[model samples]
Target: MITLNHYLFVSGALFALGLAGVVVRRNIIIIFMCLEMMLSAANLALVGFSRFRVTDGLPDYAAQSLVFFTITVAAAEVAVGLAVIVALYRTRQSVEVDTITRMRG
Candidate 1:
């Protein structure tokens, strides 16, 4: 049977991986993907906690609602972020963060 700790552990591991990817990767797209992964990990943990702590098997609606909000925010972030990335790519011909430093005023 899956326990709360098990879910927490997996979520933590996934979040760590995402953080590593964001820190180590040079590409903007990959960094965005990593951020998404981290958000997903948080959502998983939230749902897991809600499910495991509640007496009823139906699970908590609050956590699920929060997850929906998180997903919406993530979607909006991706849309705006990807648009910026595309603009940067068009102007610089690359999506690498290092190449964008010259744009600093």
Candidate 2:
């Protein structure tokens, strides 16, 4: 039977993978994707915890509300982040981290 620990372990693994990708990858798009993955991992953990914490035979709404807000914010962040990445790519013609760093005046 699946349990809270199972959900947590999967979430931790996913977050770790995302972290490693962000740390090692050079391209902006890949890093951005990793960031999103990390966010999703966090959301999974939150939902898992809320789902497991039974109260009066009902899942907690408070934590779920927080998760809802987190998703909303993450969506906004993706929209803005993608726009910025697109603009940067157009200006520099490259998505590499080093390419962005050389933009210093």
* Highest TM-score model number: 2
**Per-residue lDDT tens digits of candidate 2, residues 1-105?**
999999999999999999999999999999999999999999999999899889999998888899899999999999999999898988888889977776542
Which tens-of-lDDT digit does each residue in 1-105 have in candidate 1? Answer: 877999999999999999999999999999999999999999999999888767666778898899999999999999999998998888899988888888642
Tell me how far the alpha carbon of residue 41 in candidate 1 is from the true structure, in angstroms, after superposition.
0.4
**Model 2, C-alpha of 62: deviation from truth (Å):** 1.1
Alpha-carbon deviation at 22 in model 2, angstroms: 0.3
Clashing pairs in 1: none
TM-score of 2: 0.92
What does the lDDT come to for candidate 2? 0.92
Off by over 4 Å in 1: 55-57, 103-105
Q: Which parts of model 2 have CA positions greater than 4 angstroms off? A: 102-105
